[model samples]
Target chain A: MSYKAIQLIKRPSGDLTPDIFATVELPRPVLEEGQFLVRQTHMSLDPAMRTWLQEREDSYIEPVQVGEVMRSYGVGEVVESRNPDYPAGARVIGITGWAEYVLGNADMQVVDPAIDPEALLSVFYMTGLTAYVGLIRIGRPKAGETLVVSGAAGSVGSLVGQIAKAEGMRVVGIAGSDEKCRWLEEELGFDKAINYKSDNLGGQLDEACPNGIDLYYENTGGVIQPLVFERMNRFGRIVVCGMISEYNRDQPTPGPSWVDINLKALRVEGFVVVDHQDKAQEATEALAGYLQNGQLRFRTQVLEGLDSAIDGLSMLFRGDNTGKLLVRI
Target chain B: MSYKAIQLIKRPSGDLTPDIFATVELPRPVLEEGQFLVRQTHMSLDPAMRTWLQEREDSYIEPVQVGEVMRSYGVGEVVESRNPDYPAGARVIGITGWAEYVLGNADMQVVDPAIDPEALLSVFYMTGLTAYVGLIRIGRPKAGETLVVSGAAGSVGSLVGQIAKAEGMRVVGIAGSDEKCRWLEEELGFDKAINYKSDNLGGQLDEACPNGIDLYYENTGGVIQPLVFERMNRFGRIVVCGMISEYNRDQPTPGPSWVDINLKALRVEGFVVVDHQDKAQEATEALAGYLQNGQLRFRTQVLEGLDSAIDGLSMLFRGDNTGKLLVRI
Candidate 1:
C-alpha cells in the first residue's frame, strides 16, 4: 500500500507557494514493536505553521527541515498497531508530521470522543492551550477586569476572549471584518468588538473600556499594540501570543517602541503553549467544561481534503479566517 | 531669607543644556496647615528626570512648564511645621522640586537618620527599594538561579546584584567600564561582570553564565537589550527599571525589528519604586538588617555643592559615575 504526504522540498525565500511543498506517494509507514500506525484524519492549520515554513528559528518549535514531512500536531485513527498500548479502533492525538499516515511510538493519547467529540478540545491541545496558557497562566485576568484581545475572531484569539469572559472578566475583541466582529460581540458575548481594519483602535478602546484595560491579550502586534499599551492601567498584564499581522510581510514589522511599557509599569510576557505541557491535562479539563457547558463556542473554517492545507495556513497570515482553520483529510 | 532655585525656563528639545534652566530668587515658602517647610539637603540625580523635561505626552508625571522649578525627589530637613503629625528638625524625603528650600505636605515620610544611620540600607527608601521591588516583586528569582543585571554598578543595579546573591542566586553584572565591572565582581560579590563598552557581550555571557540567566534586572535599554534577551532561559523574567541609554538621544529610538522575546518565552515587566510604597517598611527593615550585619554595601558618587546640580544630573546621561549620583548642599 502507498500513502500520500506533503513534504517541504526547499526552504522558501519569503512566501510559501506550490513549489515549496511536494505531494508524493510512498510505501505506507510500517509499525515496529512498541509502535502504532495511524491514518491521518484532521491536520491543524495554524498561523505558526507559516513561521515554521520560513527558515528562521521560533521560540518553542524548530523549523521544518528540507526533505522532512512538514511538522504539525495532528489527529488520526489507529489503522494498525504492533503495540498493545493502542487498539485498532482507537482515535489518538499526538505530534504527527503532515502526512496521509503517521507511524510512531504508542506515546499518543487515545481519546474518548464521547468525552470530547470532534476532538474540539484535543486539537486545542495546541491552539486551545495556546489561548489557555497565554491568558490564564500568563495574563492572569481577574474577575470584573477588562481584557482586550486583539485578533479576537481567530482561533486562539476567539478562545482567549471567551475564556476571559467566562472567568467573569469583561472581554473586548478586535478583529478585521465586520462579520467577525459582529459574531464575536453577539454570539460570543464579547462586551465590545472593534474591527481593527475599519475603526480607530485607540478611540474605540477608550469608548469600549472607559476605565482602561487591565489585561491585554495580544495576538496581532503592530500599530494597535502601541495604542493598547497606551490605554493600559497601572500594573496591567499582557500576554504576547503571536504577531499574525507581520507574518506575511517581506519587510520588518513596525511595532511601537517599548518605552510605554517601562513608564506605565506594565507586565508584558511572551509564551508558547508547548512549554506548558505540565498543565495541559488541567487546562484541557477546564476548557472542555466550557465547551461542554456551551459557555464556550469554537468555530472552524473547515477546508476539506489535504490539498487545501496550504491555503488554510496562508489564510491565517492574511487575516482571512473567522475562527480556527482546520484541514480535514 | 531668600534662596535661588533652578527653574524650568524651557522644555528641552532632546539633549538638556544649561540654557534650559534659569536661576530665580523667591521668598521662603511659609508652612500651611498640615504642611512643612523643608531646607533641601540632598537631591537625587536620576536619568528619569530627563523624561520629565521632554514635555512628553506619555509621561506619568506632568512635564515641567516654562518658569516652573525642575521636579525631583530630594531629602530635606524640616525647619518649620504647622502639622501635628511631623515636628521641626525632621529629615524627610519626598517630591520636593530642585530648590534650596521646599514647602511640602506632611504626607511625605520623615527620615530619622539618627535611628537608621547612614548605611548601605539608608538609600533603600529610593534606590534600594527600587532594586527590591524589581527583583522580589517583578523578577522573582529563585535560589540556585542565575540573574543578569544591566547597569550593574549603578545605584539600583548594584543593589539588585547583591540582593540576588543574598537570595542564593548567581549574579552577573553588565556595566559601562572595567572599573564598575571590577566593583561588581570584586566588591559586590557578583559571579561575573561584562563591560558592555569593551567585551563581546554574547561570547562573554556564554562563558560567564554557563547555565543561562533566569532573571534579568534591566536598567539599560538599547543595544544591550537584545543581547540579554538572546541568552535568557525559558520563562525568564526581566524587570525593566529604567532605560538610561535612550534618555539623551535626540532622535526616536529604533528598536530591533524582530524581538526574539517570543522565541525565548521571556517576561519583560516595567515597575516604578513609588508604586511599591506599600512594602516600604518591610523592604526598609530587611535591607537595614543586612547592612547592620555587614552583608550589604552601597556606594554614592557625591557631586559636591548644590550649584553642581546640573553637572551631577548630566553625569547620569553621560555614564560618568557609579552607584547613586547625588547632589550635596
Candidate 2:
C-alpha cells in the first residue's frame, strides 16, 4: 500500500515558493508493537509553521529537516493499530505531519469520534489552547480592562478576543480587512475592531480603547505593534504569541523603544503552547465550557487536499485567510 | 534662616544644558506640628533624574514642574523636629530635593548614623532595592546561568552583577569605557566585561557569554541592547532597569524585534523601584547581609556643593561618572 506526503525540498529564502515543497508517494509503514498508523483527516496550517521551516538553532522546537515531511498538528483516525491503547477505528489528535497516513506516536490522544473534525481542530486543540494560555494565563485579563489583540480574525486571535469578552474585558481587535473587522465585532462580540490597513491606526486604536490598552495580545509584528505598544497602560501585560507579519521578511522591523516599558513598568512575555502542555486538561475544560455556553465561536478556511497545504500555509503570512487555515486530507 | 536651592527654570530640549536650572536662596521651612526639618547632607545624582525633568504625563511619578525644586533622593540629618517619631540628630534617608534644608516627610526612614551615607545610598536605598527587585525578584536567576548587565559600572547595574555573582551565576558587564570594564572585572569580580564602544561588540558578546545570555539587566539601552537581545537563550529574562543612553536623545532608538522573543519564549519586564517599596525591609536585610559578607562593594563620586548638581546630573548621561554620583551638601 502507498500513501501521499509532501516533503520539504528546500528552505524558503524570503517568501514561500511552490518549488520548495515536493509531493511524494511512499509505502505505508508496518506498525510495530505498541504503535499505530493514523489516517490524517485534517491538518492545521499555522503561522508557526513558517518558523519551523527556517534553519534556526535556537527555536523552541527543532526545525523540520530538509527532505522530511513538514511538521504540523492535526486530527486523524487510527485505521491499523498494533496497540491496545489506540485500537482500530479510534479518533486521535496530536502532532501529525503533511501526509495522508502517518505512524502515530504515544503522544496522540484518543478522542471521541462524534466530535466535528473542524471543531476539534479549531476549538479543542492547539488553536484553542494557545488562545486560552496567551490571553487568560499570560495576559491575566481583569474585568473592565481593555484588551487589544492583533490578527484578530485569525484562529488564536479570534478566540482570544472572545475569551476576553467573556471575562468582561473591553476587547478591541486589529485585523487586515474591514470585512474581518466586522466579523470580529458583530459576530464574535468584540467591543470594537479596527482594520490595520486603514489610515490613522493610532487614532482608531485610541478611539477604540479610550481607557488605554491594559493587556495586549501580540500576533502580527508590524506597524500595529508600535501603535498599540505606545498606548499600553502602567503595568500592562503584553503576550507575544506569533509574529506572522515578520516571519517572511529577511529583516524584521525593530519594535518600540524600551524607555516607555521602564517608565510604565510593563511586562512583555512570549509563550509557546507546547511548553504549557501540563495545563491542557484545564484549558480543554475551560474552552469546552465556553463553547457550551456559546461564548466561543470559530470559522475555518479549508483547503482541498494535502498538496494545497503548501499554498494554504502562505495564506497565514499574507493575511488572506479569515479564520483557521486547515487542509482536509 | 535662608538656604540655597536649585530650581528647574525650563525643560531640556534633548541633552541637559546648564541654563535649565537656576540657583537661588530660599527661606528654610519652619517645623509644623508633626513635621520635622531635614538638613540635607549627601544628595544622590541618578540617571532617573533626567526622566523626572521631562514633561511626560504617563510617567510613574509626577514630573518635576518648572519653577519648582528639582526632585532627588538624598540623606539628611534631622536638625529639629516637633514630631516625636523623628527626633533631633536622627539620620534619615528618603526623597528630598536639590536644597540645603527641607521639610521631612513621614515616608523618610531613620538610619543608623554610623553607616556611611554612600553605602546607604548605593546599597540599601533605591539602588540596592532596584538591583534586588530586578535581578532576584524579576529575572529569577538560577545558579550556573549566564547574566549580561549593561551600564555595569552604574549604581544599580554594578550591584546587580555582584548580586548575580553571589547567587553563583556567571556575570558579564557591558560599559562604555575600557577602564569601567576593568573595574567591573578586576574589582567587582564580574566574569567578563565588554566595552560597548569597542568595535565588534557582537563578537565580544558571543565570546563573553558562551552559554548565551539568560538574564539581561538593561540599564543603558543602545547598540548593546540589540546585540545582547539576539544572543538570548531560550526562556531568557530581560530586566529593563533604566535607559540612560536613550534618556538624553530627542527620539530614543527603537528596540529589537519581538520575533525572537516569541520563538525563545523570553520575558522582558520593566520596573520602577518606587513601585516595589513593599519589599524594602526584606531587600535591606538581604543587601546588608551581602555587604557584611563582602559580596557587595560600591564607590561614590561626590561633588563639592549644591550648585555642582546642575552639571553633575549630566555626568550620568555622558557616562562620565565611574560609580554612584553624589553631591556632598
Candidate 3:
C-alpha cells in the first residue's frame, strides 16, 4: 500500500512556499516490533514549525534533515499495531508528521476526544500546555496584578489571557488588528486589548496598564514586546513562550534595548511544553476544570486538508486568524 | 566651613566629559534634628553612576537631576552628629555623592576599617553585596559546575569569581586585558580567564568553559557578555548586575538575539544591590569569613584625591582599573 506525504525538498529563505515541500506517494512505513502505524488525521500548524523548516542549527528538537518527511505534531488513528499495548483503531497523538501515515516506536498517548478534534489538537497538544506552563507555572501573576499577553488573538495568547483573568489578574492583550483586539477583550475577558498595528501602541499600552506591567507573557517579540518590556514594574517576569515575529525573517528584527531589563530588575525566561510533558496531566486537569466552569474559552480556525498547512502558517505572521489555526487533513 | 561637591550642570548626550560637572564650594548646612554631618572621604566609581547621570526618567533610584550632586555610593567620616545615634569621628557608608561632605538624616552604619581603605569600600559596600546577591543568592551554582563571569576584573566580577571558587565551582573570568586575566587566574584562583580584548574570545571562552557555562555573572553588557551568553548551557542563569558597556552610549548598544535565551531555556535576570540590603549583614559575615580564610582576594585602583572623580570614572570603560576603581579623598 502507498500513502501521500509532504517531504522537505528544500529549506526556504524567509517566506515559505508550497514548492519547498512536495507531495509524493510512498510505500507505507512498516511497523517494527513494538511499533504502531498512525494514519494522521490532523496536523497542528505552529510558529515553531517555521523555525524547524529553516536551515539552521539544532533547537529543542532535531532539525528535519533534507529529504525527510516534514516534522509536525499530529493526531491520528492507530490503524495497525505490532505491540500488544496499542490495539488497532486506537485514537492517539504523538510526534507524527505532515504525512498520511506515521510509523514510529515512540509511545503514543490515546486522545480522549472528550473535546473536539480542533480543540484537542490546539488546546491540549501545543497551545494549552504552553499557556498553562508560562502564565501559571512560570509568570505566576498575583491577584490584582496587571498581566499583559501579546499575540492576544492567537490560540496560546488568548488562553493565557483567559486563564490569567480567571486567576484574578487584570489582563491586557496585544494583537495585530482592532477586530482581534475586540475579540480578546469581549470574548476572552481581557481587561484591555491594544492593537500593535496601530501608530499609538505605546500610548495605548501605557493607558491600558497605568500601574505598569507585573507579568508579561511575550508571545510575539518585536516593537510591541519591547514597548511592554519598558513598562515592566520591578521584579516583573517575562515568560518568553514564542518569538513568532522573528521566525519568518531571514534575520530577526532587532528588539528594544534590554537595558530596561537591567535597570528595572526583570526576570526573562523561556520554556517549551514538550520539555515539560510531566506538567501535561496537571495542566490538562486544570484546563479541563476551566472549560467545565466556563471560566476558560478557546477558538480554532481549521483549514481543509494537509495541503493548506503552508498557507495556514502565514496567517500567524499576518494575524489573519483569530485563534488556533490548524490543518484538518 | 565649606567643602566642594561635583554637581551635574548638564545632561550628557552620550560620552560624559568633565564639563558636565562643576566643583562648587558651598557653606556647610547647619546640622538639624536627627542629622549627622559626613566628611566624604572615598567614593565608589561605578558603571551604574553613568545611568544616574543620564537623561533618563527613572531607574532603581531616581535619576540625578542636572544641577544635583552626582549620585554615588560613598564612604565618609562623621565629624559632627546631633542625633547621638552616630558619634563624632565615626566612619560610615551611604548613598552620598561625589563630594567632600554630605549632610543627611538617614541611619548611618559605623564603618570598621579592619580592612584596608579601598578594599574596605570595595569588598564590603555595594560592590560586595552585588556579587553576593547575584552569585550566591541568585545564580546558586552547584559544585563541579562551570561559572563564567564577564567584567571579571572589576569589583563585583572579581568577587563573584572568588566566591564561586570558594563554592567549589570551576570559575572562568572574562576581562579586557591579558594582565587582568592573569591577575584573576593567578591571584583569585579562577580556573581560567579569557581576555575579551583578544581576537579569540569565542575560542578562549570555549577552551575555558569546556563543559559550557552553568552560571554567568554578567557585570557588563556588550560584546563580552553576548559572547559568554552564546556559550551558556541549558538551564544556565545570568546574574545581570550592570551593563557598563552601554552606560555611556546615547542609544544603548543592542546585544545578541534573545533566540538563544529561548532555545537554551536560560534565565536572564537583573538586580540592584540596594534592593537586597537586608542581605547585607548576612553577606558581610559570610564574605568576611572568606577574606579571613584567604579564600577571597581583592585589588583596588585608587585615585589620589576628590578632584580625580571626573577622570576616575573613565577608568571603568577604558578598563584602566583592576578590582575597585575608587576616588580617595
Name the top lDDT candidate: 2
Going through the candidates in order, the fraction of native interface contacts each one reproduces equals 0.52, 0.89, 0.52
User: Could you give me the TM-score of model 2 versus the true structure?
Assistant: 0.98
Q: What TM-score does chain A of model 2 get?
A: 0.99
Query: What root-mean-square deviation over C-alphas does model 3 reach?
Result: 2.4
Instruction: Give the clashing residue pairs of candidate 1, or none.
Output: A59-B263
CA-based DockQ, model 1 = 0.49
Q: Highest DockQ among the candidates is held by which one?
A: 2
Off by over 4 Å in 2: none
Writing each residue's lDDT as its tens digit, candidate 2 over B1-329 gives 79999999999988999999999999977777999999999999999999898988578999999999999999999999999999999999999999999899989999999999988998889999999999999999999999999999999999999999999999999998999999999999999999998999999999999999999999999889999999999999999999998899888798989998898999999999999999998999999899889999999898999999999999899999989999999
DockQ metric for all predictions? 0.49, 0.89, 0.57
Where model 3 places Cα greater than 4 Å from the true spot, the runs are: A29-33, B113-115
DockQ-best of 1 and 2: 2
**Candidate 3 lDDT, B72-107, residue by residue in tens:** 887888888887767788778788887888985475
Error of 3 at A84 (Å): 3.2
DockQ, cand. 2: 0.89
DockQ of structure 3: 0.57
Ordered by lDDT, highest first, the candidates read: 2, 3, 1
Score residue B116 of candidate 1 by CA lDDT: 31
